[model samples]
Target: MGQAIVVTSGKGGVGKTTTSANLGTALALLGHKVCMVDTDIGLRNLDVVMGLENRIVYDLVDVIEGRCRLEQALIKDKRFESLYLLPAAQTKDKDDVKPEQVKEIIGRIKQLFDFAIIDCPAGIEQGFRNAISGADRAIVVTTPEKSAVRDADRVIGKLHSEQIEEPKLVVNRIRPNMLKTGDMLSIDDICSVLQIDVIGIIPDDDYVIKASNNGEPIVINPQSKAALAYRNIARRILGDPVPLMSLEEKPGFVERIKKFFKLG
Candidate 1:
């Protein structure tokens, strides 16, 4: 059976859905059959981010409510043939589906895909519980800030209490220059507080905004720093020992030449 991993954050606006869309896309690029499930219900946006909004004839609610078959509800990606999206219902509330129902839906689809990535709703509520109910692993997305880290810690605690052990962390929207200038928390600082292994570190990049607005994931943009980071994260998920990208500003040609010549 495929792994069902939930991409979640305790607080909203921390790039949980973006991470889900990009990571699912990246994994598919690596030859894995991936499906991204949006469990945010009424506030769903994964379909839009994946550019499959208009193609969604049926959604998660439709599958659970028996209005459509499981295969009929899956919207295949236009770019990658292996990537699919199970969008949440925009017209329904979170209570439309219960946790057991979510688990049953995921269980049925897990056999057909290599990975099932659930884009969880923000906060600790019915939506959150339903999103994680069938997940085999959990990926907690957070920013390198006090509030985000604190909320992540709380979410991690709740995950463990619910028997979802050893949830990994992904720190998003990190500014290396801000960290150097003591204006933001470092990755080490956030990891120290959350006490979880860091699986990914996404840098703050304008390309992310442009790609999302254009209905494309940044992971497909080769020039984007955030894209590179996310691709590395995908490799890590598949047990590759890829080093974290150097977030510091790259050295100029002059500096590189000077270093090559052993001169200051």
Candidate 2:
């Protein structure tokens, strides 16, 4: 059976949703059968990020409420051979669905896909609980800021309380200049604070925002550093020995970042 992994952040605007989108896309690009679920309910944006919003007819609530079958809610992305999306209900609140119901849907999805990625909501309330219910593992996304790191720590503790032994960390939006100037938290700083294994370190790149706004994930383009970082994270998820990226914003960064990731 395949595994379900939840991409969560206790705080909002830390890139959990973005990370979820990229990871799923990267995995699919790597030839994995991937299913991404948006569990944010009323604030669903995974569809928009995946650029499949226009194709969504059935949603999570529709499947959970028996208004439609799970297959009906699963939107296949023809862009990838086996990438599918199960979007959250736009009109329903987080409380409309229970944890057990979410778990049931994900359990069935996991059997069909190589990986089931859960795009969790922003808070540690009913939505968050429901999101984690179906996950076999967790990827906690955070930023290089004091408030984001602090909230990530809380999330790690909460994950342990829920018996998720070790949730991996993805440090998003890393500004290399700020790190070099001691203005931002380093990877060591964040890892020491949270005590979790670092799975990804995404650079703060303008192209990533542009890709999201344009309804295409950056990973599809191998030219951007952020895309390379995300693809590295995906390789790691596949148990590949790709090295952690060195974010050096310089004159020849494109070539240097490729060498760091050992990509052709």
As a TM-score, model 2 comes out at 0.94
| Model 1, backbone clash pairs (residues 3+ apart or across chains), number | 0
Question: Following a full C-alpha superposition, what root-mean-square deviation does model 1 have from the true structure?
Answer: 1.3
lDDT of 2 by residue, 154-196 (tens): 9999999999879999999999999999999999999888999
Residue 63's C-alpha lDDT in candidate 2?
Answer: 98
**Model 1 per-residue lDDT tens digits across residues 143-209:** 9889989889989998998899999999999998899998999998888788989899999999998
Please give the distance, in angstroms, between residue 232's alpha carbon in candidate 1 and its true position after superposition. Answer: 0.9
Off by over 4 Å in 2: 253-264
TM-score of every candidate relative to the true structure:
0.97, 0.94
